[model samples]
Target: MPRLSLIASCLLGLLLAAAPASAREVSVPPWGSGESRGEDLSIWLVTFSPGDDVPSWWGHGSLVVEDRRLQQSRLYNYGMFSFSDAMLARFAMGRLEFWVGHSSVGSTFRFYREEDRDVRIQELNLTPEQRVTVAKRLADNVLPENREYLYHHYNDNCVTRLRDMIDVATGGQLREFDRAPGRMTLREHTRRYTAVNAPMSVLLDFMMNDEIDHPITKWEEAFLPDELESQVAALQVKGADGQLQSLAAKSWNFYESPTRKRPPAEPPPWGPWIFALGLALGGAAVGLAAWERQRGSRVARMLLGLENAVLGLVLGLPGTALFIMWWVTDHTVTYRNENLFLANPLTLLALPFGVALMWGSQKARARLFKVWVALVGLGVLGIVLKLLPPFDQDNWRLIALILPVSVGMAGAFGLDRVLARLRGGDRASTGRSAAATSLKAP
Candidate 1:
């Protein structure tokens, strides 16, 4: 997937900054309210549901500190970033910087409400000291020098940052969740959320490597906002009287958007469907090749060339990107992708052969046939690797999509005849030339 263009980023920045003047004040709730137990302070977890945009597809969360005495609420958001060229360049280089910034609760809620995202709030049941600590930490986090931090999608994102702070405030009680197994892998979680956009889901799955496929702990799963909310709601904390109570003093759906629905619990079942689509395309290519071979018609040959070109571009472009992601960039999740075998870069290199085949070049036919065979072989190799203990990438969907197409195209172009002729050496070359001449005869 391409990075957000500068224009889109700027527009998003503007939208984020366009809050009403009354809601624009940066309010930090007063932590010291004269009460020895800090009775006037309250902390809440605010979670916003996923939105239509790519960036908002994973959802977001913020820490809200409220001062009951002053009736003021401040939201500490860790998802802020600039849209300047320098920041975008760094983002493209996989070194994005995000910072914590304070905004009025009114402004934050207004923006998300306008976007039609669901909002949930949970009042944290923290002791007075814990509440004071969390409030002060959030205040310190928004400071100019302290706010900026390196962002890691799975480990140190906005949600995870809030999760860590909560865990610390609870005296590491959240660490108890490390023993529980996660429902799915990071890749699956990502697919589940992004499944609302089918193409984007597949593209992201293709780009990510096996690093995200391992089973994680529930603690790790808290990287997502909803997951964290669920885990936090289940937590039990000891009260002043030594009785265990729910960590969430109160929980409620603050705003449930009628237009936007929550993402599905599981990722879409797209593998089999994509495989079937590939088979259909491959069959069509074979039929076209057969028609061209039988009639030697100009139209059939043109269609054959066009099919090859289209397939080449579709496979080659992403394959080239995968190559760059593995060796040229710092996107760790995209490194060592298994899809590279299915979408071979050699297909791009064989563009001239595709064009030549359009003009009835025998040499191009031979070369293109060889390239297709190599691609098919690589696809098979990927499957074979799956049988080994070391290769555990879940890329069957891609294999299913690319393998049959390679096989069909190779068969369509007469791979057997090409190989037989090549084995026959000098005699076969002369025979091919005579055959070409004879076919051209009126």
Candidate 2:
């Protein structure tokens, strides 16, 4: 999360500029000209699958074209972005600008291969004219005026760029013919890639709102590189014989990561459950102790204080962060988040109240008990919404981790209040009896 290094950014630009020297211009022949460019025109859908680096975590996509007539092989990449101060600031604000960039196919492949990333190459089925059209479009996209675009991760990223370019070249054949639905939603697809980085996956789920919940069609899910390649492989277009033909003639991996492993279909489902159960158990124990009036147990006091500090800080920090993201940042995906209710920064008020309740009088404890109950109610509402109709947010993991702590804190605080009230009632009754007996004797 540190500021982007200026020197590293400069070096990155230099590396990209120096990587490809054998690139050539693509010609745009007039449309409907039956002239065959007899050149060995090779068009490929290049997919650079995820690697260990944060930048490559979502993977990247590019179009590779080799025109033997010009002895040129170039990769048209739609994932390039400057790391300048202004660009980094915009990226952090979620208004990133990415650009189409061209480099030698050799250079592109070498970069991914050296990173130990998984790289797949699918030879595209294109007519000589279609091939020239794709090349020309790609070249035009890489031009200074046309290259830069507003980058939206799910809708207008590297993968979607390639999908769109192919769609345009084949008369929208890729999107039109690729209609099979996937078993997972866009959120699930994202989880598959980020699972290896648990913290990143959790942070992503926390920041992104319900915008990614609903199921997406295969064409829509092609925002991911793997999904895009798979969808395109089965895509069909009208052939010369008036029959449907596969868009990809053949597919093979250019570089397979030596350390690559199959990621889980989604983030581990059991993680939230385990975390919630721990909170529930702690709450039950504290409630039982309060019911028995175990004020003398130093261990209970210590545990209660520890719970308050941990839970209060845990809930408060992320809630504050999420709230800021919703209002302050340009990340549309982070806006209108429901997670705010569960972990409101206002819950941080509990930390101070918790200390006072442990050491202060019954009046102080009673006053703060309502706050605890309110926090618990918020968490319950979040959990309940997860089961209700039209609620599609995938936050079970979070609800599981947070709700139990809320429940435990509420129970402990409530039981303490009940015991305090009962003790006060008993003391008042004894005073009344003594006064009545003394008055009668006099």
Candidate 3:
């Protein structure tokens, strides 16, 4: 809550001034008219319910409007602070009053209250000309979109009523003053929208003198950009001579949404689906072994184990790869490869399959298992390295192969031991048989 002490009011007059241009009177909105012209408030509150009867709740908080005089020097400053202040009042009322630069970094159209920053106010009582000089000094640092808003119109205070002054005048056209936001309409916007208030330096000397606006704090959810944003999907960008370029795009919001998590569905239907698939695969393996035996193959046992390894690979490997591909590439979606969409859980399965194949194989199946296991292992390792804290959304692709490479080495070593033991045993058995035959013949 922002306390409006007498000291705050006294600080207001001294806060800003401009070379006196003809002073113009400010108007009151229809919703702002109260029982008395003087509510004993320095600022008045105006409420604009949503025009479309959208069931938005706006009356719960206090709204205030202040009379700020603008001059040539303070002309731009008015656009900055007055609008910014008005927006703060709107948010305090606990509703969407007006939008500044609807969630952009360093957006110009904004609203803010002095109390939010713990900034103290002083009464300067400067001549009109001096005010203009100070106001100009502040404009140099004003950015178009900023994720900073303090005590918006809905905070049980007087911030909401006055936030959309210029916006209301332009028939709810915020883009005129807030060019920083890419584009928007009232009906289509959501909570992800953000706005920034004019920097304090624009209104006060100390703001610029002390560099108070640098490294600002207090970013509200309304202003922060989500992992995925509408601007990329909706906005149209114009090139130098006003030709429409390709539609603006941003990465999709693919991170697990905090708002939509749910527990696994009851009875876990996958329980049955999994069993059926295993049975089918088992039947296929039996048929394969039977055919190989009819062909007089000596690799029957090895082939059966190979079948298990292959089934395990099918049970889980593709999901790991698909998810890694998506994450590494900034959540860009693509078609599934081989009915497999790689995901984290699938990676775990890939590992087990690799281990199973390593221990169960008889011959050629072992070699194939080693190759597949190595690739999957390396892929998993790559995903891990990419996910390390230092590598964020920007650099994930760079380390995507760490798992594939690492697994390749493991598979190689395992294959070597299997080959050495199998060959050595075969040779020993042959020697024993030949020696026994010679002794018996003699």
Candidate 4:
């Protein structure tokens, strides 16, 4: 599971690079900055929930917005945020001020400021028509097409929302496959946070000046008195039923500076860290529950579960290590490298060895179990250490590692627990093994 997740993470980076794309930058001053103080101020926010028309093939994003005013852009899948970068040159040769925040699927969250600017925002008089237009355009015009700018997404959230436009334009004929109308099948993703434009960069951005049920005073802190006095504020869009749309973008007072600090969410340093570790605990809890069902072998099942988990951790490490090495890089369009590694020979052989160590009778090779456990610990350590610089940067790009690490860690642990309980030693009979994982053709 973890190996497959690594491949998926690496491949997602590839797909973001290889997809078909377009670019459109809206000219707006940074949220609080106005005319003289700021010229390139812009804010682009997009949300892609499950029910929207985005194609599953495109792997839709959610809650993503890029604002040059705030100098921040965070992409999302479903409602959770994923990190993404915008080329500064992509925006008419102006300097960028940015920030990022996102949580992983299953309640994990990460977000923070990358660079804090002393810049202040000004309030421009926007006509009611202009305000409606901006809101509707956000709902309609921006954040649709998604990805494929050849390098990074310049408001891909809005481009992705364009999927809705295409669907409406074609009367649902363009992308019938993903049009399930009302299914809660949204899958959130986690990815990178980038700054500056490389090669395929483009311009136009968004800035945020939020005012929830927040203190009017804190707003004064992040903005100049003149700017705050000008009166630009966030809008609240609620459906008739008051339910938030999957594709809705809202500017809320999530946090403010000085008086109310925004705490950071950091990366886990070791293997089986955080999420997977939680999963292991979850599996252990389940094993504890099943303890009563097993004949005298319950103790053996617990031990085997430990062994299977260790071996799975070891077997999946190489692919995972390889994945962590390049998970957030913009080097591939097809991400086929990690995908291919999952099916490698060594991984295949190791799966059964792991299973045997877990399910083999009480007399199973304790030596093999100990050896595999040591190897896995080393493999995890080596990868975590190698992951130092970029992988562990303050950037949310590290979130990509969570899926693989957690899944692989959990799958191995869970399967081992089950195999121990069942004494399901016959890998051939079950006809399942690590060799079964691999890349898929598009």
Candidate 5:
């Protein structure tokens, strides 16, 4: 359950940025100031690598404006947000507000360095005029009224904001060149970063709908700081002399953390392993149920009841949350989720029936068997839906994990026997009921 809470808190963690409590406002020179001239100004993109905290897993980015004449540098970041109750409320509702803010470049580096996160910087190959333009925009972006923006995890965030700034300075050349297809979809990119925490990765995948499955261009992939860094480095933009040049004039790692390793290039292949685990659990449940049926032992019955109660919580709580995320919240990514079929909220009904079974109530066993059958049926329906084109969700991993469990549990609860009785009419049901009573007699 604590892991479940972590998943809830980190649902928007990929959109998070490095938020240092010591962040302070830094003054930026006016646009008309002599220091704003092209040659006197240089712009750099500062990228921080994934950190230990879930929020910092996707990394963070900020734009640094250096004024050689003034011997000063300011780091403008769009990731700033407070953890106040109001902000948390909005975050839960998917209306969180993030803002641009600036601090001394030295302090920004010091913060991430102490956190043991790697830092990289790339100097843009912008011409004199473009440098001034980008610097001026960075300055104006920090103005109180202009700073705030509604955060969208994929479409807009700290990294994408800096990416758009670069595109503007490049006169849209960055966007033009990055229109080529990306290496992976948005969901794959997310899985790449979140793979460090396996549970978080699976839960997030379950919560998100198929909207993230569409193919995206490299420009759209710039939503991640590392992707933006790589894309910008590979780009060619027009210089002051009207000649094409590399977009990244120079790039280097500013700091490398000794403690942290970089995120994996690809997501871990956990599907088969998860499926095996589900199969093993389901098999154990069937074995236990068979033994209970043969001996009518109190111990076996209690164990079966315990298994039902635990599974109910394991599946039901997240299923309930997913239901709300689809219908109640503004979190568009979680809408129309197909995982709802496998992890159905109706599984929660097993709790009371399980308790009744533990108390040796035959009626509870009959009702629980029907509930398990319904759950199995829903899981089968989900599989059937996947055969259609419109329901093109990449949920094979989830299906592999949940379907076997549902089917095995239903079988363990005597689904075949129940179905046979229903088809055999009242006469056969009377005989089956008498046989069931004789089997249960101690």
Candidate 6:
């Protein structure tokens, strides 16, 4: 999930900029600008639970630094970005830019609380020298000249920023965390959160390629806010007594929202399965019409031809988009997709011939018969390829949904053409036999 706070903060930034210059500058003390210094500063890791919005589905993370003497708290957020028309275009193309921002902790906490999102905080155990060093690093990072960073969704984000900064403060001891056994792939982790957002889950599954299916290290999974929080809470570091100590000295939930009603029934494999069934039924009807050659069979054939052409055109879109992302766009995860063979855009180019067949062109139907046979072959090949190495894509759901439809549609058209041709030959032979008998009798 990208930063949900980014959109809100960007709008707020624009509104504040229109005010007077003195007022435009947020009253929050600039990072490290307070009169008080030394160990009076304490470091905290703040986490906000997942929200209803798409961007907030995975939650958020922020680092808070409090000055005891000044009685003020500041939040260092790595989730801010400048939103604009140009930025939207770049964002769509996967070239993202984000900035570290400084803001008052009171306002930040209030915002999440009002949104009814659960919030938690972990008081980090850091030496006085370590605290000052981390604070200074954050201060420099939030400076106008040093803030902007190229954001990668899974590798570099708000949560990762906090994790990295803490590791720095801990003298790399954070990296010594024991790997959690039986780690999951990035896709699995994402699916766990987005299961309720069925549509988004399907779209993400389609757009992202096999790159996400590879198992991620526990450290890599810490990019997610909740994962980072849990990992930080469990982290152990060297203590002054020569024993391991928990990195978090204390932890507590800052806010808890009212319970939410359970969501409606989810449409998981159901949606894809229904789509396959519909296609299969339609193909079956076409096969029956071709075999019977009834008075209305021509119309039925035309309609089936037209429908498949349209369906083919539509199905090709995701594959085409993936192709662009892999070859043309900068989206790293979409590169090297194995789903291309199963959802080839080349099928869409057959639309012109499908239209011709719909208009009752015998020549077009003859050519399309061959195409349908090829489709059956391709479907079978796709199934066989799944059993091979390097093609080991975990796309069983997609394969289940699409392969049967392909085979059904192809068999319907191919077998119909063959049966019709055989019947025509039989009728011609019978007519010739009847004419020869009549001539001989005369």
Enumerate clash totals for all models, in the order shown.
0, 0, 68, 50, 0, 0
Best by lDDT: 5
TM-score leaderboard ranking: 5, 1, 6, 2, 4, 3
Q: How would you encode candidate 6's per-residue C-alpha lDDT over 1-442 as one tens digit per residue?
A: 2332332232221111110001112543533663546478788999887766666666788888887877877788888766566665566566768878877777777888887887789999887777778787887787778888877778788778889999888878776673554267776776666676654565566566777777767888887777788788888887656688898999997787786322222224445654666477546646654643655567676776676677566545565666665785577777866666656655554466678867877786666556555655765776688787776666666566566656666666666666788889999999999999999994
Candidate 3 segments exceeding 4 Å error: 1-345, 350-402, 409-442
Off by over 4 Å in 2: 1-38, 83-89, 265-267, 271-303, 351-368, 382-392, 422-442
For residue 18, model 4's alpha carbon misses the true position, in angstroms, by: 15
Q: Give the number of colliding residue pairs in candidate 2.
A: 0
Candidate 5 local lDDT, 354-376, one digit each (tens):
78878888887788788888988
For the record, the alpha-carbon RMSD of candidate 3 to the native fold, in angstroms, is 22.6
Rank order by lDDT, top first? 5, 1, 2, 6, 4, 3
Give lDDT tens digits, candidate 2, residues 1-442: 3422332232121112111222344443222132325246778998776666555667677888776665666787777776557775565566777777777677678887887877899988877767878777776677678888887878887778889888887888777766656667877776777777665566566666888888678788887777778777878877656688898989998889877765565656657555856577556646644844755665565556555766666567567666765776676777878777667777777666656545634554555567667877877777677677666677777776666766677777777767778989999999999999999994
The per-residue C-alpha lDDT of model 5 at residue 305 equals: 81
211-266: candidate 4 lDDT, tens digit per residue? 11122332222111111122223222232355433222224322223332211122
Q: After superposition, how far is residue 38 of candidate 6 from its true place, in Å?
A: 4.7
Per residue, candidate 1 scores C-alpha lDDT tens digits across 72-132 of 7688888887656776556545677877878878777888888888889999999888888
Q: Which residue pairs come into collision in candidate 6? A: none
TM-score preference between candidates 1 and 4, better one: 1
C-alpha-based local distance difference test score of model 6: 0.67
- Give, for candidate 5, the lowest lDDT window spanning 10 residues: 1-10
Please, what is the whole-model Cα lDDT of each candidate in the order they appear? 0.76, 0.68, 0.28, 0.30, 0.81, 0.67
Off-target runs (Cα >4 Å) in candidate 4 are 1-350, 358-373, 376-442
